[model samples]
Target: MKRRLLTLVVALTVAGYPSAAVAGDPLSRMTLAEKVGQMVVSYVYGESATSVSAADAAANEAMFGAGVTTGAQAVEKYHLGGVIYFTWSRNLTNPPQIAALSNGLQRAAMADTGIPLQISTDQEGGTVNRIGAPLAISPGAMAIGATFDPRTAYDAAKVSGTELRALGITVTHAPVVDVNTNPRNAADGVRAFSDRTAHVATFGVAAERGYRAAGVGTTAKHFPGLGDTTVNTDNGVAVTDETREQILRTHVPPFRAIIAAGAGSIMAAHIVAPSLDPTGVPASLSRPIITGLLREKLGFDGVVVTDALEAAALGDYTDEQVIVGAVRAGVDQLLMPRSVPGAIRILLDAVASGRLSERRIDQSVRRILRTKTGSPYVVEPPVVGTPAAVDTMNRIAARSITTLRSAALPLQDGQDVLVTGWGAGTTTNLATALGATRLYTGSPSDTVIAQAVAAAAEHDVTVVTTSNAWADPTQVELVQALLATGRPIVVVAVGTPYDLASFPAAPTFVAAYGYQPPTIAALAAVLQGRAQAPGRLPVTIDGLYPYGFRAP
Candidate 1:
């Protein structure tokens, strides 16, 4: 049996295929350099030296040395264990093309490494998608929560993961599980599942389950919670005032539930939890947060990853310091560390100098190996993508749009829908797609707002799309315009849902807790009465909608 298994492994390797055991074997044999390489996930860019013509061999060598490659040689030379597959920034929207490029890179990496590397991405479906333009889903997370059914959440994730896995991606950094409690949140706005922990927990866990069931590992991210911070960790602002009680009650539950559900990983947020750790270091590098809080206290056994160390989330730490601090903080992976070799050497040096223990290094590596061990084998007839994948996404999204009216959402061909909001474009797209005579009060004046408003005043039915755009003044202006149209307004919030507080007198309101494409379609479908809206409010709309309010 042993010999037969060995023969199978050899055969699989020769045929250029990946399996769970083969993927597991390399983890045990990895040297410190190799193990460290596995821990480092970095972005690749092409470079050339000495004016080497684009086709010149020396120029090619320079580019390869610069950590960029088209095929196998990169993995062999760099000894890379995983890659965050991204297109060259210039070409972001073309999914099929990106998918093709990623598939080729994965194949080359496997050919070079003799192991299937962990390919990852941030395909969070809304505005955060790496794919742009006509393919851009929605602008944020609140949109999806508006859809309300766990099954719809699952379907959305399944579709997203299917598209990613077809391109050879093994993991996704998504389902932005953060609760959007802070209306003035500097960054998390529409990206959070909701303001209430329970609802956010529900949406997050369901999304993770769906992704994993579809063969992609799910990462419940910004651990210890990111909803309370008023600063963007990406740009050097760091904060933490969530009491240990609040963290445990609200923020930590989703991470715990998802981890319990066999989530492959969790990304640590850059914000500091000051009550837990007085040092003010971000959770990504705090032993109390990562080790004591997550590992020991909450008992999350899955991989604990750091949010991008290159982000100014670290309080003025140098590149080397950031790497060392993150590893020491109990994070299993240092995501997108800016200096790969230098960071590796710093970690090795720290371990050598007794600043970082060998035991500590082993712990992180073991968790990483465990995470990899769980990965599904990537097979190749070479996964081909079709428009059907997008169709699935749209269908699932259509199901998530929630309808809260006592009466059915009445939509007729000629009804003038007074759609206005920060995410007017999204609702406008959905309204247009639904074959409605819609009106917009915003830009691209060629589009008819006056005609639509006049039509709304004449017709009793209107649907308004409005949202608090990170406290921007525009959302308020749009809502005021729609209200003045004096139609029976069916206001659809395609954002943080806070703008409803500003227009409390409006009737027939709907909140699609995010601005992603699925939410747009979901909202449109619900408004058209083609789908049932099952979601309850995941957050309090303070001064407007009460928490847990749902219109049957």
Candidate 2:
């Protein structure tokens, strides 16, 4: 009940709130389609929220289903309880468009099912951030964690939540509490706040409070933990071998803190922890983990959502397998099922065949209803990219620059510096900040490496930038080639902080955690001796550095 109101999205509440599902138990009135719909969220394929334009309609038919034209049509056809926004789906283009879309989706849901759709998206900032520019662009969890300031975490989420809510989105899947133990992990990277469970809990709780204050719902995600896995469920089966005891250290603390802090939702991860469930299904659908650990052990009495159901992590588990597994595991909301109508059918079939009881369905639906009807998430319109917000974002970035070698910074004023890296224009930003020539290249190639090496030889200092180089080895090869130039070298990881592990042989190393404009500017200012590299490592680099390592 505490999770239902002011916790965060029991959300996607629009301006001038809807009357549907406002006061009574709406389950008795809902048909089977509507009941199942409450357990699932559908993805719309268009830009407009209400009207399905010709392009929007065609795309919907091609992607989601046929004859589903608008948000209203989607709710009417599938009886949806939630809608998720993704930039890849073109559902989020700009602020005004998103606001209109949110209002439109709520209006359609109210008109059709007397409910409000919890409009959701991944706004974790840094790399997982879906919408960019014009919005308050802040760094990711790791970047904020680097500051070791609870207020920074709180302010960053508030800035993001304030803007997202103004655009009509009620739910943001963020504050990844996964205690990143593996530096090679692609899924958590900077998205995770810290490797230490206590730090993760501190930042996660602060962020949740910030979102609640902003009238948006927050999700403590990738549950039980995905910190040990190198790949995401989108790529392959990301299994964690951490025993139940091990989990209590790396995974359980942040979740425990958030639940106590009044989290509205917990998004189960697709990765599997065999100690929690020997069945090998993802944690998203694991009864031992979700119901046994999160619900019973952690004492979380709130809405539970599964990571995307169509993820490759589920590994051959069809919609039926996953839907039944998740529902049985106690997941309250299912996201991005390949087919919304088909997913609804699965729920109905499960209920009819006794694989899942109607009572179970009613329980999840009641939670959704309580969240939607409890309160209207109302907030004043936020100014996109305000100075104070920008200053806060920049401050976090400035504080998060972890420099490895002190002498390598403050590049001598007259020294010729050649800046080059593998990310598009990221190196250019670094180059511009340092007033150095930039030889920008896309993913590395033999020819590009040769060219970069030759150009580095001509400069007094060679600066190289890397983005998740731990995942892609080509950047490492390029960095190695640049080091061969025998010039003073400064290697800056503009993305994942783990990139330092890939090029440890470099003369100087710095981890920026993110490559956004603010981060790049901060790194440049730090290098120019205009500011201090005050950041400490949020995650350890195995044998190389300990957590909280800062340059002398």
Candidate 3:
């Protein structure tokens, strides 16, 4: 049967149908159950989960059942179209383990349907990286935007894609193209490239091209744009109040560019945009937005994936509602539905009842199968922790470090310098790189604040690192206390650029845009005058520094 199906697919491809659509030709060959299964992408634990603690093991069993412990088990039970990997859930340790896991999933999938599985991860770089440790971490989207060079975007994504492909991941949920115009947007921050539509479009296309060059599928995500929202949909509903014209002008351009560049998938945002859909439904469940706007208006025939169905924004809806609503909304894949079995049952029941037509289900299944067959996962030799990849990542980070205020640059060697902040590892690494005489690590506690202040008083210069200080009042208070010491301080906003607005009185400020080791080393080099800071602010922090601001 498998040979016969392969022969049919080859014939269709030779007949000149697009290779993607040819593999799933006639769609009538699949049973209703198998077709329904193609619309679902389930999550499974990696091999590393075998070493998890008793409590975590029990929790995983409770959530996914004892039978669904491994990717093969999940594929066997759910007949899923793809697998979504989470480092925390899977406890993934290294590259070899990830490759083994991918191969296992693919073998299981091939046995079931003779089709490859779409193995995917959120390798967005910086803080959101899941394929952790030893992989060369890039400086993320905003850092690439800070350089204002599309080539930097291409190189960063190509390296990232190469590493991901080598590990057997076929799809990367990355290159967030949202124009993060609102400085107060907590959800987007450094994840977005820039506030300018043109910048987002230009760099977004480049990143997409890089991913394609490396033989991995790229997802231009959180569409129509989550850049204007202050609330993260993972926790609660976020409403975008931009007028329709404003959205068309600002938020929609980058997605258009990415689609034009042939992005394989698009992840719809969970935020509500009343301007796009008058019903005020979150874009993930709105047919007007996904089908009418994205499909009809934008002419995107690629897969439309919803953000995780379990997000708090969809809390009011039941698992059945979300599964059915997303499909009815014209989504091709339902990501991380609360229960795989429950979702499958709901979809089957929806078709059985008059709630959903079988034709709609088949349409989605064909699109998914086409994507899977056309983009077969070809495993590359593992390249994690390779020297050449690391070098490229470090060079990109060095170029992305933006020195906003540099009155204290060229710190004298052997100077009495105190380094302190959140992300203790980054602080320690930067301190060691800069030859700081002392290091104090602390969160925003009263005791830590007191210790930091005393240490600041004793040192010739103080270097304070902040990761989202504006959001954490404790960090804000700690920085304020350090500033009150009347000691010369160079503040390093390592996570988000907006931290500078909270500490405007600091003598000098630098925006690293991330906490990766390479970015930290770049920050250290800039302080020691070993490297020049060339990055420009990607977004305005209002009352602090405007976009494109950099020290002379």
How do the residues 1-552 of candidate 2 rate in per-residue lDDT, one tens digit apiece? 001211122344335563334655567677777888888887886677657568778877765577776765786567788888988677888776777677666666656666667888999988888888888788988988998888988988998998887777888998788898877787888888888889999999999999888888888888988888888888888988777789887788999999999998999999878888897878888888889999998898799999887788876877788889899999999988877877888899988999999999988888777666433233334357778878888888888888876647778889999898867778877888889999986678889989989898888888888888877778889998887777788888877667877777777888888888888899899887889899998888876888888888
Question: Taking the tens digit of each residue's C-alpha lDDT, what string does model 1 give over 1-552?
Answer: 001111114334312444433533454555666666667775543221111234443333443455333333544455555566444522233555444445555555445444456768788876577654444243245656655566667767876677677555678898788877787777687788678787788888888988887788777888888888778888876676778888788878878778777777899988877888988877888888888988898778778778876787664778776888888888888877766667777877887798988777777766765655332333443343346666766665554555544342667656555454344576568667666555555432323445555666765566666655446555555555556866566777666666667666666677776656556667677777767776666567776666666776
> Which consecutive 10 residues in model 3 have the weakest lDDT in total?
12-21
Query: Clashing residue pairs in candidate 3, if any?
Result: none
Q: List the residue pairs that clash in candidate 2.
A: 8-217, 9-217
TM-score of each: 0.81, 0.94, 0.93
Q: How do the residues 295-318 of candidate 3 rate in per-residue lDDT, one tens digit apiece?
A: 999999989999988899999987
The Cα error of candidate 2 at residue 452, in Å, is 0.6
RMSD of each: 5.4, 3.9, 3.9
TM-score, prediction 3: 0.93
lDDT of 2 at 184: 76
Compared with the true structure, all predictions reach lDDT values of 0.65, 0.81, 0.81
Off by over 4 Å in 2: 1-21, 373-382
Shift of residue 498 alpha carbon in model 1, Å: 1.6
